[model samples]
Target: MVIKAQALAYFVVKCTFSGPQDLTLDEQLIRTPGIWKLFVDGSVAGKKCGAGLILSSPEGFEICQAIIFDFPLTNNETEYEVLLAGMKLARSLEAKHLRAFSNSMLVVKHFSGEYEQMDPQTTAYATKIKDASLSFGTFELSQIGRENNGWADALSRLASAKTQSLTGSIYLTEAKTPSIEKKECLEIRQGADWMTPLRNYLEKDILPPNRREELKIKYRASRSIIINGRMYHRSFSQPLLRCLNTEEQYQALEAVHEGICGEHLAGWSLAFKILRQGFFWPTLKVDASEYAKKCVQCQLFATVPRQPPEEMTSVLSPIQFAMWAVDIVGVLPTSTKQARYCIIAIDYMTKWVEARPLSAITEEAAKKFFIEQIILRFGIPKICISNNGTQFNGNKFRKFLHHFGFK
Candidate 1:
């Protein structure tokens, strides 16, 4: 005889922990190396109940999971459900060491023994966790909030009663929004190619009975032939070319170029590689070259050809105080109503630069600055060059420069 779900939940909680808010854990120990990680979060609204679990290897990310619960459960009970299931999952995977995280402070505190066992159900849950931990290499469970936990939060919401997360299905949709593009995964079905009929006719004694058409097919099939159900293109200089369907060809190309044991070959190398492996398709050479062209990883790591686009060309300044290059820098941080923009002038020969800050960059202010900083201090320049900004290009600033006889 089994008790009601609520009664069982209450009993488990009562056994494992007291209803006090004072439960807490000490500073977490240093995380063990090569330990697998598990993230679990539970959701309960009205009477609906659900849990989410994400397990990951030390090197790879996001090990997939499948979980479902029908019984009525509180948020804490649901959390316990997730925790137990996750731990069992870790054990089943033969994971030697494990670390689990949850958003439930009560569950983390109670299970970690920072709180007293006042509820039997809680006590039961905590006891189970202790027993389960010994089966793995090393196990630790800690608490985290929803902050910076977008994936776990989204997965949790998806598991609730109002929503169902189908595998690889879109969960949330905003109406009238543009759909996102997705990558295509290639798969090939057996007997879905031109060579299938030839293979069947030659190997399994299957044939269409139109004598004339059949004879033609047999004659053409002889030069580029099917032997023992494997299609091969006859070659005079080298070995026969074995045929592959879409998926097999893709995998073969990957193995040749970028597989775990691949050499990351160039286009011609890749084409020759498939031939050396005795695999063939009509577009084998073209496909290998195209694959190398479209390979994102190879493109990212490949050496870029580098050379100067044109011959060296630079204007040499004749003398000091003859020419000045002028520019303005910033709308920088404002302080005590001080200026934010700095007007800068560089002497072409001496490499000396003079700067003055102004609250505003304007034609009038720039004229005044030129008179004080350039005209009076450094004498007149043969050429005053500046970028075509409003302050430099305006008719008034040009007239001011003309008044100072600056070219």
Candidate 2:
């Protein structure tokens, strides 16, 4: 027979005539009770931070969570966050034993209790890790090669590169709250700003009892109101602007002149834009001016050349459906009823065209056309564009827009 000349070769998974002796690594893992395998990774690129975690149970079940951090973070800090998040996830799963793996040697050593955390930030992270680990009956942290950590590493890179957020096992988290420090929420007490007294009286109706102060508060508060716990500054010229608290004011300042959508606008334009966005802060003009001075991009990139007075000026629309251009066509040959001009309205973005035929193109006809065709049909727009035609520039049209909360 062909088998007569062959010699047997024994391997780990091979069975002998006596019995099965040795087991493969996979078989050994399956025999372990309640053991969960965890892999975690983190990355920071272009001032963005992301973390990824993968957990495998003894039954070969795998789950994942991909995290994206809005604020800046270092690689080690991100790694710690991933590890802590993974442990918490494991505890939630009722895992009593865990074998965690990571490519970060620093994290592995910290968790193994072989290294001291010298950095104050790292100390807090290590403490949290240690505290989270106590729930497990047995826990082991070790470092593996990057190749073996492909899932988590790839997940971290994916989260970092994602332009938009996704749902289900992936989340975009904003960590603007203070790190490694305990701070209280901003509270607006009296004398914080000029509007403090006005706020106290308007919301709480708790006016100071001095005769002069009470009169001043009453007069100033007549223009303000509380809507959904937010104080507002109202005007006949624009929509009601929600006054910002101290923390929110800082966020608005940063978002306006330097945040992602910021083009570093000038002080007046910046203040007006913030108000136009339906936000108001005390000392808006002064704050915007101060913040603009510190913007390096604006100092280097901004150059507003003066334009001719009547050279078809262009104003940028703030957002979608916020601006509309209206103009009158020529006084055409009279139809059956002598209808002359047509008032045409078009949205700046969507190009949705609307037109109204007019008998005389008088101010009254224009007003009725606007109220019916534009406001009732679509919605109120922030700005209405028109030339110096008396039909549009008349005082009545101005009052029409003002009463409708147009900007």
Q: Write the per-residue lDDT of candidate 1 for residues 336-384, one digit (tens) a residue.
A: 5687989999888899888888899999888888888988898888898
Give me the displacement of residue 117 in model 1, in angstroms.
Answer: 1.9
Off by over 4 Å in 2: 1-31, 162-407
**Candidate 1 TM-score, true structure as reference:** 0.34
Maximum-lDDT candidate? 2
Model 1: lDDT equals 0.68
Candidate models: Cα lDDT each: 0.68, 0.72
lDDT, residue 28, model 2: 67
lDDT of 2 by residue, 42-138 (tens): 8888766777777777776667655666566788988988898789778867788998888899998987778888998888888778877888888
Clashes of 2: 0
